[model samples]
Target: MNTKIYCLEQCFLPKNWELLLSAVKNVAGFCKESGKYDIPTLPVKLGHSLSKCAKVLRTKAIMEDNEDVKKSVEGFLKLYEDEWNERISVKARQTLYDAKFN
Candidate 1:
């Protein structure tokens, strides 16, 4: 079953957005060239991963069943709903800025 990882419509802050946009651009190119891989929606999966990355950052993770692991991730994602939108907004602005420049 596919799970909605996180809704990032109204979260995200004003900092670190540029990094997110940059990563999205880089990852888009990488994923396109790399064999089989998911084509992530900009500011969507990118935001989800950002939120999850923050929680898992510098933390040790244990292996688990694949399905169970995906569920566990969704549970973790729900907890981050609070911060996702803010992060997305900020990243979007950065994307805007980069567009203005380049």
Candidate 2:
């Protein structure tokens, strides 16, 4: 009965579906690389890329009617949300900036 659960029941065109899938893959790849790298400023760069990809998935989800595509978008949203929640603080950002400029 939940609206969020029901939203995934819709369908989408094949081309749009493909695009959504590609965005999901790209986001996943960025996430993997972000976790793999230990460089101080790497998360910021990867997060930026992930955010862009998440935005694409979000936009596609709004216009897509396919249940599969909706599910994929939902998964990516959850994953990225968790990643963002653990984002580096301003202190970390300052450290990265100082490291680059100093």
Best by lDDT: 2
Model 2: residues with Cα > 4 Å off, grouped in runs = 1-38, 85-102
Please give the distance, in angstroms, between residue 26's alpha carbon in candidate 2 and its true position after superposition.
16
lDDT of 1 by residue, 12-88 (tens): 32233444444555654433343212333455666666666644522322333344444444444564465545544
Residue lDDT tens for model 2, 1-101? 11122222221222233343334334333334333222545545655665576566667766875556666656665655564435332333655566679
Best of the candidates, TM-score:
2
TM per candidate comes to 0.27, 0.41
Task: Provide the lowest-lDDT 10-residue window in model 2.
Answer: 2-11
Judged by whole-model lDDT over C-alpha atoms, candidate 1 comes out at 0.45
Give the Cα-based TM-score of candidate 1 against the true structure.
Answer: 0.27
Residue pairs in candidate 2 whose N, alpha carbon or C atoms collide under 3 angstroms: 10-65, 11-65, 11-66, 12-66
